[model samples]
Target: MSTPVLVINSGSSSLKYQVVDADDGGALAVGLVERIGGSGHGRLTHTVDGEKHRSDVAVPDHAAAMAAMADAFEQHGPDLAAAGLVAVGHRVVQGGARFGHSVRVDEAALEIIEELSALAPLHNPANAAGIRVAMDTFPDLPHVAVFDTAFHLTMPEVAHTYAIDRQVAADHRIRRYGFHGTSHAYVSRQAAELLGKPLEETNVIVLHLGNGASACAVRAGVSVDTSMGLTPLEGLVMGTRSGDIDPAVVFHLARTAGMDIDAIDDLLNKRSGVLGLSGSQDMRDLVDAVEAGDADAQLALEVYCYRVRKYVGSYLAVLGRVDAIVFTAGIGENADEVRELSLRGLESLGIEVDGEANRARSKEPRDIATAASRVRVLVIPTNEELEIARDAVRVTGS
Candidate 1:
């Protein structure tokens, strides 16, 4: 693993990237090109070091975004050539049951990932396209796919299996394939380290709250249970995705609302959650409205935090001996109000967040638990790209 690796987290319309030193696993540079297909006015902003380098790139697709990201690297801080990015690692959304671990991308795997688009219509195809573009852009480099669901492959049949017909489940591969595995896996280890115990002996819950959110219960480092089921939309409320809707709602919408399958799909994936509950997708606006006495915004925040709290309490019971509760991802790491509200009134379960410490914004992982609390509430920033790079190195022996 002496050669550096470039890790790409490709979304439907954006590509987030980081270059890591293969030998030491240190991130040399990281940036993201967001808002790809927003409107006639589109922008790609790459922030490296302390400066931001932006462009008005006509990114009609992810391929264009990837090229713009490359241009950003050339113009910004670290030079890729000097960075020695010998290999590339991709964060694939749904690798399906076919891949349980990171593997070198082959023609067969690419086809399988494409086949999985039905499962993750909003994600898999875009991810496959990004992989294809990466293969084209860096033909000589070894490309690896670190799956989002691979870490949760450890879930027992009872945890992953649904209460449906066995034949239907088998036909559709309809089982829990949790997302944010890299974040959950990374945070679990960090929580164990912070507790100074062997991961196998430690029990922790990880809550990943970003544009998308999910909760996981990690026992002995393996994901024994997680909130995300089959897809990212099954867990906690998110920016634009509904979580844990009634099974009847799908059928009801199709029947009464005259909505087709794709229409319903788009509604759940793109127009629901906090955005639908409140009026804005951004939590900042929601929070602002809540402070200004907006009932709907307040309700959205309450619902969001309550769902997280429910999972935390449930996971504590599942683990039987809770070591820590980890808060990570964008909202989990930065939103003080979300953290404070989510862990409130959990002292009986040995989980407590220090009011003063929770408000302190630190870049490094910091425990925000009150000294008296038995279970520590930690704010551990997730580094999924770095984790992908480490795995890529391990799998490839780069």
Candidate 2:
């Protein structure tokens, strides 16, 4: 009954992979191949049995990366050919409206993924390329694509629809397609379980706070509304992304700063967020700066947490009656100060975080809410890889 599945998240120049056991919900092996196709040497880091193995080599392309990955498994641990891999799951960032759930990857499905690259110019092409190379490498294994956008497809039409020029918006497919859905789905289910309520009856607000953050309002285990819109660049203030900015800022910058489309995009996505306000992007660094009385860092933290609080309040309104609020991902899980600051002043709204519980250092999921609080506050660590693996197995009937 050991159903092992390999989950792949292919980036533009890097490949991250994990061999996850769907039955046990544990990662058997995890690895990363970085700097693919770069002019300099690439690096491969593979870990198994809590041991790390590293190698530096020339990874000229996805094909070379896949071969390197196979070599790592063969040489270090968990030989892939003998591992009984049920399927290979890929993390495709954009499924568009075409794919509402995980699907077995075929030539036709691959083509659709590639065609959707326009929606995720920076992600889908690399995903499709990796799928092509992975299929060539493991032709016998069933390959499945679990989209980050798929879970949010349940959003009602009013929630997803943009009130722009209807014809123009429709032609461009300009509707909200929230990201971080895999984490949202995984964390929301965990929240429901923690509440000891049927997932169908539980209403939870899931805040996936990583370098890229999003808030999802899950009513009856389905995404009703999310902070992100049309792209990852929207929603909460991310590490480097200016989330929820006025659209006219772009036009104003074009007219005044003479910035072009690409330049503006780079500014909003790479040079904004906490980095734009303070010279740092990492929450740890920002926290350090704030502790040291760095005014800019303090302001950055304020902006970040204020945005999160705004979404929490809005989602509270959306859900009407909530069961719990769950926080997951790197920042949400480890940054105690962030969790506290984000939920600050929400006590009147029935959301209160216990100081000691919030500050406790534990990896396991636990409640951080005060005993008297009406709504429970939870810190649930997200396991997106395991979620992907499980979805892959279910989709392929493996």
Alpha-carbon lDDT of model 1:
0.87
Per-residue lDDT of 271-379 in model 1, one digit per residue for the tens? 9999999978888889999999999999999999998998888888888988888999989999999999998898887777889999997988998999999998888
Global lDDT scores for all candidate models: 0.87, 0.95
Evaluate residue 243 in candidate 1 and report its C-alpha lDDT on the 0 to 100 scale. 92
For model 1, how big is the CA root-mean-square deviation?
2.3
User: For model 2, how does the per-residue alpha-carbon lDDT over 92-192 read when each residue is reduced to its tens digit?
Assistant: 99999999999999999999999999999999999999999999999999999999999999999989998899999989999999998889999999998
Model 2 scores worst on lDDT over the 10 consecutive residues at 57-66
Q: Tally clashes: model 1.
A: 2
**Residue 249's lDDT in candidate 2:** 100
